[model samples]
Target chain A: MGYISLDQARTIIAAALAHGGQLGLKPLSVAVLDSGSHLIAFERQDGSSTLRAQIATGKAAGALALGLSSRRIGEMAAERPSFVASLGTIAPAGLIPAAGGVIVVDEAGRAIGAVGVTGDTSDNDELCALAGIAAAKLKAQNA
Target chain B: MGYISLDQARTIIAAALAHGGQLGLKPLSVAVLDSGSHLIAFERQDGSSTLRAQIATGKAAGALALGLSSRRIGEMAAERPSFVASLGTIAPAGLIPAAGGVIVVDEAGRAIGAVGVTGDTSDNDELCALAGIAAAKLKAQNA
Candidate 1:
């Protein structure tokens, strides 16, 4: 299985931040994680809230843990809140049922990594993640 | 059960790191925990992954929780995946189900504490834990 390199992680973060800036969104936080949900890189912009780091990492890690994007996880949470809540307790990085998390896929559609962005509307955050992935020339699974 | 002192915990960490260096392994993180599974000391080398600290602690804490080495827990996970996964939800530190966690024993063969190392291969990590325990003049439960 492929993994997200530190270089690609940095590029994702930079592009995500740039996209958020262009949209005039609130201070953003971005996290990139490998397939195992281990953090490769993370950055929270100035004035971002204290919990941004956890929230960002949680989004990406949660997506990887469940083999679904965080947006899909949010839908699952809506359908079965208790089941999703139980999983959050078990997940080491915790789970954030939101739209900002997107899985990065390889040529064969196997998950390579994930990216999560926070600090704006969930939809806006997700847009930034997509923009970042596009800038890095990586595929976003089911995007 | 006896507890590991802060001084001894530090010694374990230092010696573990020294051993990793001698072997030219990747950057490592070490955690020393008391009999109660409370952290006594921790150290993550520069350039180690972001989850190193949590993984290290989880290894040692998982050992204490099941009263077996983390290596054995990994075997249990392989044999009974769902059972081990369920326990991970209840475990506060989370169970990693991997090697590198070793339980330290007192003269009477009772558990005193535990040591966990991470960063390189699981076997290499376990070797570092063993080296640390020996350097501290402690005995591993099943070494």
Candidate 2:
């Protein structure tokens, strides 16, 4: 029963976009996914490429599925490209082992959801998502 | 600027499951897709088969891509099996020419989104989807 609310999702998205703008990043697409890796809400800022949404969703799905930040997934993929490629076959939406996917944890340290961003460099996208979660007074567990 | 909200998608899924329960149908999986055929929300009820989600998504994707109910697509598939089969190659998520997909139209007669249900017979699936859309006070444009 503990899940991200629509208002919370909206706040995360708005703050993510605002943070991206503050960093002078390109237009971003953000996706909020519940613990089940189901999309709760998504938004694409004006000027963002249409493919951004899919990238954002894939990042979030990969993070949630593995309970790790996509940045970490990227590192793992680097160590074993073939294995990571195989993971894509089983993962829905195809896992993107890239930065920008961060888990949204509740006060109890439970991962309630995740926020993924696409636009700028992977590090910058992760920065924006973390800033958004912090702005909402929530915990971002993808260190 | 109008689009299907997460709240509306949630309401539709809840009502769809409730309708299925009332009708004593089998376990169901429902998928809601935005007008662009992107997944907005999804739920697979307990006891539903693992394939239900994919089937539901394919059905909704087929309906949205064609701007018609999946039943109509099924009819077309029946008449021109080869052509319809070829369509699956290009269709995103692979089209399922079944009877359970229904488009959700707005008051302005624009297709806002779609709901697809799978579990019982395709007829029962379509019935549950339509009931859910009706409960949301939305239009189901499936003749």
lDDT of 2 by residue, B1-143 (tens): 35667667767887988999999999887887888887666666654544676688789989988898999999999999999999999997768998999998877778888989899999999999998888877888845
Q: State residue B34's C-alpha deviation in candidate 2, in Å.
A: 1.6
Chain B TM-score by candidate, in order shown: 0.97, 0.96
What is the CA-based DockQ of model 1?
Answer: 0.05
* Two-chain complex of model 2, DockQ on C-alpha atoms against the true structure: 0.10
DockQ of each: 0.05, 0.10
Candidate 2, residue B82: how far the Cα is off, in Å: 0.7
The lDDT of each candidate is 0.86, 0.82
RMSD of 1: 10.0
Give the interface RMSD values of the models in order.
7.9, 6.4
Candidate 2's C-alpha runs over 4 A off are A1-57, A60-69, A76-92, A99-143
In Å, residue B70's CA in model 2 sits off its true spot by 0.3
Model 2 chain A is weakest, by summed lDDT over 10 consecutive residues, at: A44-53
